[model samples]
Target: MPFPHDRPTRGSDCDCLPRPSDTKGSDAKASDPKPSDPSPSDPALPVYVLRYQDAWFGMEKRVTFAAADLDAALAITEREPIGAWAELSQDGVLLCRRGGEPGGAADYWVVD
Candidate 1:
């Protein structure tokens, strides 16, 4: 099915609304219809940005990866260095920050 962006705008002769033929009917058998929720295998999963900054050296690195939610992002942060600071952002907006201080929150802060 064509997304809104892919469709023709108003006043187009073809209308360009998604054609009913593009979708399966109720009686039709679906292909991969039951995709697992929040799984890495799902191509529609949301992508998040993880930025790491060294406390002393001020070195910075950014990683973009797919995650289902904040908890998944926290799980990925477990592999980061203990003393380094990390920030999780989505769509260029800061979601939370963690690390860089002794006995900080085990997970992250400022966002659920």
Candidate 2:
């Protein structure tokens, strides 16, 4: 008895995998669309700053703040005591309006 053998078929109907370069152009365009300018409704976005005990001293600690809106929040943070950080959250309840170290000095307090 002889063993059965199968031959491979080649045609458009065949299910061969595509080569890497086959979809390069179209895929590149779709994947690399030009970035757009910032939108008004973008999130507050988080940022941080370190306050050192002194100019030569290493970072003493970090301060945190949150802006309900991005531009206003950034502006508010910019005008603060020294170093301030900001983060955007749908729920920033843990964050109080007050500015200070998480467990240290009290800088500014947020008023409801």
TM-score winner among the candidates?
A: 1
* Candidate 1, poorest ten consecutive residues by summed lDDT: 103-112
Using all chains and alpha carbons, the TM-scores for the candidates as numbered come to 0.49, 0.23
Clash totals in order: 0, 5
Residue range 45-111, candidate 1, lDDT tens digits: 7778878885456789787888877788778766665346678898898888765446664544546
Model 2 lDDT per residue over 1-112, tens place: 5222233444333335654556776644555645563433445445333232222333344445544454555466545334342222334443333345777765553434
Best by lDDT: 1
Quantify all predictions' global Cα lDDT against the true fold. 0.68, 0.43
> Cα RMSD for candidate 2?
11.3
